[model samples]
Target: MEKHPRVKLHFTLTRSSWLNVIERWTGQPERNTLYHGCFTSVKDLRETIKIFIDSHNTHSAKPFRWSQAADAILASVDPARTSMILNS
Candidate 1:
């Protein structure tokens, strides 16, 4: 890590809900394009991704909806522990 002074590292907990959400979102493209598909070159892969993104944006793009209410989300956290972590 010292070799790249400009790089920053972020650590997330195992089985984090936020990480799961992102994985689930990206899994669509991986399953649809990359899983059983093969590309001749990097350019081909780029074009495939571009087409997938464009089609997804045009037809199925929608804002993410939070399943939990703000208060419920906050309630799941321990306020004292959160404060301690923040202070650390």
Candidate 2:
């Protein structure tokens, strides 16, 4: 890392929050199009996924909105709130 002075590194303590958002978004197609559907071969599955991605990108893709304030997000995951959720 020291060899590349211009490069910066970012580390996450847990799964990337952005990755969770992406997974949630991609999961829709998995549930709606892939699940319980039969594919004759690897190519078929690839094509299906491609078609779904293309359709989504062309029709339903939208810029993600971050409406929640950071404080609100922090509050929701505070230790006290986590304990309450776990105990319940």
Top candidate on TM-score is: 1
Instruction: Give the per-residue lDDT digits (tens) of candidate 1, residues 1-88.
Output: 7458797555444447778767876898899877887999999999988988899899988988989999887787666458657644
**lDDT by residue for model 2 (1-88), tens:** 7468787555334546878778898898789899988999999999999999999889989977868998987976686556666644
Work out the TM-score per prediction. Answer: 0.51, 0.51
| Global Cα RMSD, each model | 7.6, 12.7
Clashes found in each candidate (C-alpha, N, C closer than 3 A): 0, 0
> What's the true lDDT of residue 44 in model 1?
92
lDDT of each: 0.78, 0.80
lDDT of 1 at 60: 87
For residue 87, give model 1's deviation from the true position in Å.
Answer: 7.6
Please, what's the RMSD in Å of model 1? 7.6
Q: Pairing residues by index, what is the TM-score of model 1?
A: 0.51
